[model samples]
Target: MISSTLIFQSEMFSDWIIYNDETHGEYLVTVDHSEDTCYCTCPDFQYRKQTEKFGGAKLDDNEHHCKHIRKVIQDGCS
Candidate 1:
């Protein structure tokens, strides 16, 4: 787990986007307020289950957080 805290303002939801360094691309990151979760089009998030099973590092304590989450937090997704 990366012991870092990334905070985002509540209003950043509308402008939140996911950027990929490898592909030099960007995608919209959707947040499900009702479910209190976020989703991304990146392959990391798409195949997170397999990644975790293979012992890839988790973004947070649990398997919930990922690079996408870190990006959102670092970008101030408020």
Candidate 2:
């Protein structure tokens, strides 16, 4: 199960504190609906957030795609 807590919310912005079950690591997630982007205080997210594709057509949804971001979006940003 995913463990997360919504720390802040507003019309266009929100913040979430989520834990990685595997490592039990905590990360701060920020979602901005106005920009249609999400950010996470995690190395994986930081490294891959700007990557469009990894191995010539492997593909990604967008520039701001990651597990933490997905978790936030899954929780419903709108």
Residue 10 of candidate 1: its Cα lDDT? 51
Going through the candidates in the order shown, the clash numbers are 3, 0
Off by over 4 Å in 1: 1-15, 20-22, 49-62
TM of each candidate vs. truth: 0.49, 0.71
Task: Give residue 24's error in model 1 in angstroms.
Answer: 0.7
Best candidate according to lDDT: 2
Per the 3 Å backbone cut-off, how many clashing residue pairs does candidate 1 have? Answer: 3
Q: To one decimal, what is the Cα RMSD in angstroms of model 2 from the true structure?
A: 5.6
Model 2 CA lDDT for position 41: 78
Question: What TM-score does model 2 achieve against the real structure?
Answer: 0.71
What is the C-alpha lDDT profile of model 1 across 1-78, one tens digit per residue? 222223233532333555556666665555434334565565666675324343333333336555666566565443
In angstroms, give how far residue 19 of model 2 lies from its true place.
Answer: 0.9
